[model samples]
Target: MMTRYIAFLRAVNVGGRQVKMELLRALFEQAGFKQVKTYIQSGNVIFDAKGQEAALEAKIEQLLQQNLGFAVPVCIRSIAAVQAVLDNNPFPGVIPDKDFQIYIAFLQTLPGKEATAIIATLQSDIETYHLNGKEVYVLMKKNTGAPPFSNTYLEKKLKLVATTRNLATVQKVLSF
Candidate 1:
């Protein structure tokens, strides 16, 4: 069966790298994806493809490097997977409104034990995180301004490529 997938791309449209979403969408289509749709410009591509998520990840990364002239690490999750992420959020009562932004950072791989311990050491009142497999749920209180547990911090401490999206954005992607 065909699956609706969200390709959460990392290192796109950030740190001086410019990638046009329209061009990225065209690459996905040229790579054999259907029902192509893009969310924002942060490299969120929702497309329909048939294959294992791992294969799709590799395929898209290759296509991006070849066509876009940069390596974009992609983490693919199905619609059901995204729904499960919402259902599995560890911070139950924290509503993702203007006051708070609940984000899920998709990791390149499951963090190792050492990395998990390091992440645990980063516990703070402003930011809270829970790691489940390759996904990390981060709750950021808007009162804190910029979050300490940013994608850069997570990638640096965990030594993995990570792409984050707010719960609100995930909900919007599900609507597509």
Candidate 2:
């Protein structure tokens, strides 16, 4: 049976780069996905495909590169897995309207604390982070553009590949 998977694409419609969501849907369709839907402009897609994680990731990445003329990282997870990630967020009940934000940073493989200690040390007043398995939950209570205390710092500090999506987008994806 086909399983529902979530693909989080990096650098799709941000930083002066623009790719229409309809185009993204079509690309997935062209690659033989059914029930294709996108959550937000940041390249969150849900589709049903018959395959394993590694194979599906490669297939989607190749299709995206061929259609978009560049490389974009794709993180894939099963629907139930994604639901558990959201349900398992330990930092809920944080202020909802403040500068607070929660992001799920998907790792290609779970990293040891020794590998992430450097990033851990760089955090300051603007950040608080928690690691739950393959997901990193971050709470940022500073200005919106204040260097995104959670994301950029983690990637730089860890030296391992990762991608992030806000809690709002994550919920939207889960609702699909």
What is the lDDT for 107 in model 2? 63
TM-score of each: 0.91, 0.88
lDDT of 2: 0.80
The lowest-lDDT stretch of 10 consecutive residues in candidate 2 is: 144-153
- Cα RMSD of predicted structure 2: 2.1
lDDT of 2 by residue, 59-156 (tens): 98899889888887787889998999988887768744566777778765567777556547755687777777777777777675567644555766
**Residue range 22-93, candidate 1, lDDT tens digits:** 998888898889999998888889999899988999999888888878788999999898889888889888
The TM-score obtained by model 2 is 0.88
**Runs of candidate 2 exceeding 4 Å displacement:** 144-146
